[model samples]
Target: MSLKVECQKEELAEALQLASTASRSNSPKFALKSLRLGAESGLITVLGCDGEMWVERDLACEVIESGGVLVDAKFITSLVSAMPSGQVALELLVEDGMRVQQGSAEYKVLSSDPQDFPEPPDFGGEGELTLKFSQLQDALDSVLYAVTTDPHRAILTGVQVSYDGATLKLVATDTHRLAVRTIAQEGMGSSLSVVIPDRALRAIRSLPVGADDDVTIRFGMGRLGVEAGGARVVAQMLSGAYPNWERVVPSEFSRTWQVERDQLIDSLKRAMIIASESANRVKFSGSGDSLVLTAKSEELGEAKEEIPMIADNGQIEVAFNGRYVLDCIQQIRGPGIRFELTESTRPGVIRPAEDGDDYFCVIMPMSLT
Candidate 1:
């Protein structure tokens, strides 16, 4: 119930904003709506939680008293944000709660009993995987956008993670489209597979970490936790069998086209102007050394554009949701993007033309009709 600390204004505000995402404003437990500020030694820990998720951050500050208390996440976040730049002092003046002071400017705030705050659940400490922060974060950026936002199909709301000790795989799907990213990892003991909520992965992706620093992950006992730099995030794993993602990927795509990445993006954006009237559908007709993209709407008329592309097959035509293709194309790294398909009725695959590219998107085609 008592804690006193002094920290840089900008640093404190940033930490509060990050942790505030986990606070549940409408939770029945008042403590769940607040953040726990614990001062110990020279470190100040700021933590916020709901029952299923939470974010904790460690900030280096001068501690006047080593103790802890629960302060309103929203109020404290805003309070720190509005304070003047420079050192801000926070102290527990009485049982009523804490005081925020910077020079002569002051604010009195009420805090909940620290004992009422639910302790963050422990994620298994064993079988941890440590990999470069950028590697892990880049993998997430490639796949997270495809997870379904529907709550009824909860299993599809998470990314399926599997580590075979040498490779790390992340996959997400919204039924209509699938995004998959994999990275090479080594010395990770034991095999691991679990579905972690997309929201949790996103929360930790931007953690303040050095380029060479590694991110440590632990998954066991129905939970997954991530720690990097001075921040930590944990979430309850979504339970249920993930779809047979491997089977969905085409093992033998007969048609492949290698086209400039920027060209496709530019053409798609232009075509979408007219296609927007027709559910973002863009028709593709690839033949010889050129590819033609066309879109039409009863109200907006029709439009077409063509670009040169080296194709393995003579010709083929298909239809797709332009936005879905754009989402996958934007994530590709190399200049040339490979488009693979067997027929108009089958799923189309979008991948980088560069060898050893571990990211790809499998997009289902819309009816050409």
Candidate 2:
């Protein structure tokens, strides 16, 4: 079928930007097969991707003819992005090829058989949950950093999502540390757990924000799909059992300290500057209402910074990888945070002081010896 379309150049460029980040394959064949087309509400939608992730953008069509086709993603995006700002004509040429013409420049893109491309999984069943865009983005941003990169431990490679009628929790861990963030929601279903790949969560967070519209997440069988802002994301769930994170967190602590978020972050950043050179270790000596951060390297001189803190109970000293602490604090947004500790060797619990029945993070300490 033949069709002509004209739309904003910036819109096409933005679509290409999103698709480019998710396309990591080397072979142009698999990368090009990621484009998809669908018709709805009198608009022609074009989607591009690299199989695991997909992005869809709609352009107004004259509807001289109505059908769907798939073309090489790289060629089409490169051509469209470089085209001059103005109306561009896209037509279906003979022998399964696409013709794009603008001004004096014209390019033909050969398309593959659309029938052979992989289709996104259809999430069946009426079961679904809704979450505000702000809340969902926060949860993803906070916990996704801790997801494991080890492919052999597949379960840790994804964020574990669990929902019970009243609250939804997102947890990620890499054995050494864990991040858990929970947000309150209404109309949730039975308690369900799904391991969503870190890549998929990041893609969802990239959606345009400030829209009051709620994102709908549908889960069934072995897949989870999210629909937000006229776009949809379908991702396969990681097949395995996530570690028992709750058991690893300490139930009781002997010492608790309250510290200013910015102060702690700044201290960690300075400590990491030196610790990063040496095995990335930073020592924390807790006593009374003060904490000392120290780092040393055999080749470089040692550095220490003392920050005032609000501590209860007795004294305890702990050592941790400075990079991990910085990563955890970067996710936390607030004026102050609370840290609970049982001993120098135990995992430390850090949470926002405001306390909204939200989530908390646990960071394991490194052995000093």
Alpha-carbon runs more than 4 Å astray in model 1: 78-85, 91-110, 273-278, 296-303
* Positional deviation of residue 299's Cα in model 2 after best superposition, in angstroms: 4.3
> Residue by residue across 68-100, what tens digits does model 2's lDDT show?
666666667777888778766666676747777
In model 2, the runs with Cα more than 4 Å from the true position are 1-4, 19-24, 27-33, 37-44, 48-55, 59-111
Candidate 1 lDDT over 1-369, as tens digits, reads 578899999999989988887898887787899999999989999999888888999999999899988888999999999987999999997765799999998888988778787778987855667777777778888999899999999999999988898988899999999998987767854578889987788777868888678778887778878877788888888999999988888888888888999999999999999999999999999889998999999998998989999999838999999999998989888899899989999999999999635999999999999
What is the overall TM-score of model 1 with all chains considered together?
0.88
TM-score of 2: 0.83
**TM of each candidate vs. truth:** 0.88, 0.83
Clashing residue pairs in all predictions, respectively, total: 0, 0
